[model samples]
Target: MSAVSESISRRVTLGYIASHYGFELEPRFADGVTVTSVADTPDSVRPGALYVLRDDEEPSWLSVAVSRGAYAVLVPPSMAASARSAGVPALLATPDKATLGALAADIAGTPANTMAVFVVCGVEDDEIQADVVRVADFLHMLGNPVGIVSASGSSSLERELDMSYPLGILDIQHLLAVCSEDGAAAMVISADSQTLRPGALEGVNVDVLGTIEQLDRGGSQRAFKETRQRYGFSIDEQKRLVTCTEESGWLAGQASASRDLQSQRRLSLAIAMAMDAGVRRSNIRNALRVSKEMR
Candidate 1:
């Protein structure tokens, strides 16, 4: 996998990493050392790479990493002395998994910052996935190259879906960087409650965050409220689907009585989001007609 984007030719330095994350450097002079890559395992280490030693790992891994040409090491406070005695540059701190993910994104040039990112989080996994696919289809019809990272896998218009690993902040950033490099204008990510824990998306630059579930006025829906945009969908007595957004006015459309309520709600929210993203109403109507005919 490409560790850094080709468009981003700039390299990161150990000093910058240390200062940015408030990590203490063993040898202050080693701050100037440049880091070309990041690795968690000794076998993955390459020249000029910064190897991160997790708290549970043995201190011996630090020496092994250094011997394999690791330019710097990030170790827990307990291993600071060992790192110092190993005669290698060391960053002293035991960052949590989420913080490490943020650090990795920084080292990779923070590619997510360059594109529009939309996150879909809901209680149901299948609903989240369906919404993500429909949103991607709408964005593609709108003439924007869209990237998608869902529970199924990561893919874009230019790349096939790859299901090599579970979703994590690191993998998400890596896919985002690749999508950015491939010139994707927008990205849609699907997440469930389990993946929306504290700090899980710390470094991701999310533009729109929406959920498929109904919005409760009470604090029970606190997680859904903590976003730049909140979209709620409902079916009226007339059987018309409606989506209300904070920034945009309500969008309503006739719903098919034969269709499931949840499916109609998902499509309604997707249409509202696509319209908010600048898709013309006429074009959406045309697309809907074509979609109906195809079905």
Candidate 2:
């Protein structure tokens, strides 16, 4: 089995979840019951998993999850009575997307806390992918194992990113845990507006944030200045690379040139993010040289 699979196999007890997230437990005795996985649909429930029922779901599905040997259930307040009478460990909570994310992260051991997590957002899908690739390549060249999670897919330098859950808090946290288990020192997550919604990133630690400049693409006038001022770096449009105003000459010619404006902007943002993560100037220069030679 892969490292992530191995990590997923690790179990957590209902009591731990309740205590960690401050959820009210029904029938107090179910605390000792262990859950190996979490599922939203009854069809996905395993023998020792916890099934979270949404408010929109039919009440009858609760029995279905119980029949499938779900060790525990996290249900909406309205279902508390039904869950209590179902003869299993029950947790009373909102069961919203954010709540599920927090639960999933807890179950996965909250791995994002273990390494530097860089976030890339506010850009197109292709640009996000390009930025992620650049960041991952730079980190890997510096001898730090890195993991990547993008809208297209998830991967790590050491192995393929395998996940059974959908791309939400659960899948993302699980992937981060897997990367941590596989010894990744850092990770890059490509997030769009959907993924940036209120509860999407719950329990994950984001160390740095970067956004591609879209000034000429009808972006807000304050976008470029705000990002540069906040992050201390900006794209030098004339040179097609990043300029770190805080550390003059830090990345002079270390960035690889790109003709496409979008690619250049993404590349510049990626380099700036790497700099924020404290990558040494010498390492950046060497990584750039190595990347150029390989192209």
Candidate 3:
């Protein structure tokens, strides 16, 4: 197991998290404090686990919880000073939840950085699903074990991928954290991207999907070509691929005669995405026919 997988398996120390945030730990709760996980609700608290609390939450309850078994507390923003004064044993403080998540993952050593991180950023909801299928399928075919960070909403793709993550806990920080995970192939979808911060993953090469060229960049053509060469994609298949490569191309073609394929339980969304991108359904069927699953 990797550092991240191992981290998840074992408990981490409060000093570890504080070190990542560059915060000095109070001597009282400084060393020998180990946490199992980041607790969401107080009821799920485990011995030596960290939990973040809002300023408005009941401090008495938090105090009581810590007294019982909680490892450490991260006071939100201004409350940290106050929390410290109140003897909360606040190990670290941060206003931004995203920042907190990033710091925590940094201490714990996330495994996403080692994987292929793909994001379908800066697009509308309608345009996202089709692109997700294309890019994810492309990664799947490249012999990577795909782990999808499904940002809620889309039901079909969520059900289709066995290893899927719910969008509720996924933020930019979470995405960045996951990007560090080893042996990971991730795809994230978002409806809006106008204000996406500059230099956000600037140096990183993410296969941003949603356009025809983007589709090809994400390995749609590669998968298609490999499939075609192995069997044979004739003129009809070639024509189909051309027609559907662009969002406008396929959206317009699929507009009049729309097929709601959610009804088919066994059908992989990867196949749907390929077909939506203009690979002939027959060609996809052929590719699957020669594969172990189809056999």
For all candidates in order, the CA lDDT equals: 0.67, 0.65, 0.43
Candidates in order: C-alpha RMSD to true structure: 6.5, 6.5, 11.7
Model 1: per-residue Cα lDDT at residue 221: 41
1-295 in candidate 3: lDDT tens per residue?
Answer: 0111223424666676667566656654565676665544465455565666655677655665576456677665555565565554566455354454454454444433444444443225334455554556554553445545444332222243222222222233334344433345454343222313322222222333233223444365564444333221122342222223333343333322325433121124344344543456555544544453433
Candidate 1: where is the Cα deviation over 4 Å? 1-9, 67-69, 85-87, 96-101, 161-165, 193-198, 219-221, 225-261, 276-283, 286-295
Candidate 2 pairs with clashing backbones: none
Q: Please give the TM-score that candidate 2 achieves against the real structure.
A: 0.76
- The TM-score, computed over Cα atoms with residue i paired to residue i, of candidate 1 is 0.77
lDDT (Cα, tens digit) per residue for candidate 2, span 60-88: 78889899878888887778888877778
lDDT of 2: 0.65
TM-score of each: 0.77, 0.76, 0.52
Give residue 251's lDDT in candidate 1 (0 to 100).
29
Residue-pair clashes, model 3: 11
lDDT computed for candidate 1: 0.67
Comparing candidate 2 with candidate 3, which one achieves the higher TM-score?
Answer: 2
For candidate 1, write residues 46-162 as lDDT tens digits.
777788886778888888989988888888888888898777889999887657767878877777788777777666777778888877876776668999887665686668765
Best by lDDT: 1
Kindly give the stretch of ten consecutive residues in candidate 1 with the minimal lDDT sum. 233-242
